[model samples]
Target: MRLLEGVLIVVHIFWLLSFLFRFNAKVKISTNLVAFILMMIHFEAEGHRWQMGLTYVLFIFLTLLILKPFIQRNSKKVKLDSENKKKVKKFCGILFILIYSISSFALVIMMPVFQLPKPTGPFEVGMTSRHLIDESRSQNTISKQEAREIMIQIWYPAEVTDDNQKIQYEAFPYEEWSGTMEFIFSFPRFFFNYLKYNESNSIKDITVSDQESKYPILVFSHGFGSTRMQSYSQMEELASHGYFVVSVDHTNDAGYTKFPDGREVMNRADAYSYSFNIEDEKDVKTRSRDVSFVVDQLTKINKQDSQKLFTGKMDIDRIGVFGHSYGGSTAAQVLLDDPRFLSGINIDGPLHEPVASSRLKKPFMFILDDDYLFLTDEEIKYTNVTPEEFREYHNKITELADFHYEEGIKNDTYRLTFIAGDHYTFTDFPYLSPLLSLDINVDQFHQVMNQYILAFFNQYVKGEKTDPILLKEKKVDEFYYFETNIKN
Candidate 1:
């Protein structure tokens, strides 16, 4: 809880106790005064949100009760018979305590505290978001605009400082962003109210760490209909380990994107229409272009004098691209199309038609969820399909997976599947809410994921091969399957 919130809770508890115990008039008035002051402070801090409605009502009632002592002093002095009066006071006190305790507990649960996992790497992370427009390409079916636009947030190693304040995880206003997500997912807005207070470990636009002369660049693309902030845990972890990570929000496709000029782009009907209508191949191809454009812009930033944050610090020659879901397919497409990216990681996303058939020569990794690799026969069958059609569909998907595996064997590639993983496991959604995740332990899943991602990048990009975790054979309890084509 925030400072004022804690104060308000404490003061309310004290006021309730004073009322129950029949404290002296001075003590009751003093407690009420302190609670009222704290209530006003909390209002100033938290604003007039419905979450604080109970606090407001409680304050008003307490104020009236405290003032009643003075107004009814002469008339309220009626003394009852000792035995009945004592019993009545005892029962009322117990009831009041029970009611107050439950109410307080409920209120706290409504606005629960949530936290991001701390980065285990040695260096601290700093981040900045930039708005980039690709004038060379026209807008897709989502927007009728002339140029394709994207918002890219970059996280890099930063010098740790005591004075630096941590940044908020979402790029847009917390309430607005949370509301947008609720609208898109059709959940109640209050379901995500706790997200507003979840702050990132990253500081905004701090000085890049000079521990190394240059850092490898890794670009991240989010799943379809997801914002760049969705994979913040992974990005921050990578950035802390001396990689300059860039996450792109494809405008109109992201859940909600806010540009510097206050222009808000939402994932509306146009965006979903294209996603649902277009072929996965075309969708990923367009997204790949966005990644390539981002690489080009980053190259310019590395070369140009005007780019302040990363001019001489970025190792343009050593670049990697990785993504989740549709974005994972985008990463593979980027590897196929752009020679600038040295490696790629595709997390739980199926390979599209042409890309599935093509061979990739660069070092690559495919982190699959168990369901992606082991779909049941019943799951593969369409509701209206004949036996032959079901067979064809199953064969087609299996062939794509087989081709991807064959390509992995031909090049330096790694394949890993988590036994308890599902599609959402590859992203941070599993860590955010248990209701949205598989039945597996989210913390363990995240730990294993971060370990391997860091190891892969460290070995391939930074040429550090000291990660022992990646060299071990797959343990059945930890992974459903694991394979690597690269020879040690």
Candidate 2:
């Protein structure tokens, strides 16, 4: 809840109480006046959310409370028996208060602008975004533009200066992508205007920390129909621990991506499609090329950044790659195709051909919602297919997944399976609303997630001692399953 919003709600409830308990007329009048002022200020400055709609309406009725005396003085009193009138008025008052109290509390709770937990590391986090176009690769998918375009958002360790407090976080992280992302918002974009009050832990575009001469670079790939901002919590956490993390938004596959020149790209496949499609082979290949292209661009940016943002601050040789869902497939392929990436992790993404059958020499890991075979009920609803079709789709995917899972574990690979999680569990979507993944164990999910994610990268990318981190384990009533391979 907002500051003035909570204050106004309390004052109004108190005003109502004062009237009910027959408190002093001065107390009633003063409370109403204070609440009125707060309502006006909150509406104008904090902006109104529909969650507090009734709160506002009841506040405006304060005038009616104050004018009751004048209204009676002006000769408009109901000529009724004293007992009957008192009972009627009391019933009406109680009913209205019940409706107001219940609805207001429920609505506000439904749309809280939750604060992201602070980064657990010593350094503060800073982030900046860049737009890159791969001229070498022609547009493989349907598009008006010729070259493949990519948007990279980088989060890095920042000097803990007064500016960290001075600078404010951007309320809507995906302001540029929101318009083209109508699928995420069933109503108009204004429905999310309340996000203006949302706060982020990482400050925007601050000076890089000089504590480390060159920070190890970690490349990120978001799931299909998701932008680079999806895993912001994980990125900020890694950045705070002195890692430079860059997340890529694959133009055609992202929910939406807007370039500085006003060009926008939307998802080529059905953004709402939850079921797996065989066509992912093309996507897996194309997005894998995207990883290599981004790596190439980073190499140049490290040598001579276009804007001097990362001039010599990148420990380019120590680069690692990781991705979610489809991007996870991309990450696996990139680790195989490009020797530049020392290690990689794929979060909740099924594997495809070639990589599914091929061997992995480098250290790798896979984090999944389950065995990665069957789709949940939500996915079935989103897919909306006949029984036969669903069976066929499930069969094909699981077959490939079985091979992919086996091949991944044959070498130095790790796996974490959240028995009760869904695809969004691997991302920060749960923080927006638990409704996104109803069955997810959010607290436990994050506990195991961050612990191992950091442990994996720290050990592999920076050569930090992670203590067989990839293969450490214990199970509690089958909540989650962890596996690691010790390849001495």
Candidate 3:
């Protein structure tokens, strides 16, 4: 048996002793609280809580049934054999304790056997993924505005096991605006503490196999108020298909981030509010420059790493950028500013505010939400702009960009039209939330999404036409819808 299971069994015994002693309410509450924490830690498998809750209910029922006869016999205050009463009490205690301990132990043991299945697919392996942070900039003396240095994570295919190097957890602070994420406004600070214990903190290094093959560079930008880890499914999918994908976290823009030293940086929503017009433009440009800087750093890693793990593996010339929401706008902006980025993909972002003024000379595609029209229609119609400004901004790139709409297909992507599902589906929250099951079979969605994303990069970056699955316009999976316009 595992050490955790043994400890849980011992805890059960202590709880039984407390019940027999008629422990104070506070003591009983504390013991139950400990049990709750233990159960959550070992809940490696999903749906375990309901199973455990059911067992607890049954145990309480049986305990009451067994104790009723004893209580009745003792109520008469009549003489009874002390030995017989002691035996009866002991038997009840042992029986309840045994049942509780056995149930908990068996659940822990059987978790691995009943683990959820992974997605079904074919993928190659030459990917490397890693998170990079400039810790020096996170110091308190630095104003959040002045803190241009950021935490960026790049996922790529790699073949080296530098075991001595440590892996880091998906460390984001939930304290500042956790309350805002859900409509129920509460203290964001308290949510930080709650989130820590709930999340799995396992840190595994960027693991990839066979480092010899060359792969193209792909830069990724996550949505607003989200950390770089939010799109991990897409990152891993691309890495597994033998491409180097780099993801960046715009500091202060993400919900919150906790460094290795336990220093927590919360979202500076106040700062965003103060200078919305100027700062938003400034920040997006900064993010684009950060992507360029990351590419430069990867070049350095190729030459300097003692293990020579990165040598000849980075295809510096063949780079691409893709992002969602605010990130999607950033992707387009980066492609416009940096000629090094060969192709670009944007997943459902408003073009009017961020990229309306920018013109693109390179190829770019848009994987738009059917709801993009709802998002932009009002602003585009009402916002005042000079004719020259509108023409120079909106009309410059009208012919250069392509749109692919995910609408009206008999699949999960079509069902995504139900507002809450659309924005969250592309994010890691889909996998994290219990509500995911209510919306769609998440595993199926992940499988189809991964396939198409990889196929797009493969065709554009590597000049290879692979995965004909994306060529179809009709629904093949209930998890997605398909539409595309190839720009002339």
Against the reference, the lDDT scores of all candidates come to: 0.73, 0.75, 0.55
Candidate order by lDDT, decreasing, is 2, 1, 3
- Residue 391's lDDT in candidate 2: 71
Cα lDDT of model 1 by residue, 75-123, tens digit: 8677766988888987887787677656765565545444667888888
Per-candidate TM equals 0.80, 0.87, 0.61
Query: For residues 292-391, what per-residue lDDT tens digits would candidate 2 score against the true structure?
Result: 8887888898899877777788898898999998888889888878898988898877676667667777878778776564655665666657656777
Best by lDDT: 2
User: Which candidate would rank higher by TM-score, 2 or 3?
Assistant: 2
Off by over 4 Å in 2: 17-24, 40-47, 64-78, 81-89, 137-143, 161-181, 261-264, 371-373, 376-381, 391-410, 434-444
- What's the lDDT for candidate 1? 0.73
User: Which residue ranges in model 3 land beyond 4 Å of their true spot?
Assistant: 1-147, 158-203, 206-208, 270-280, 306-309, 352-354, 373-420, 466-471, 475-480
lDDT of 2 at 416: 77
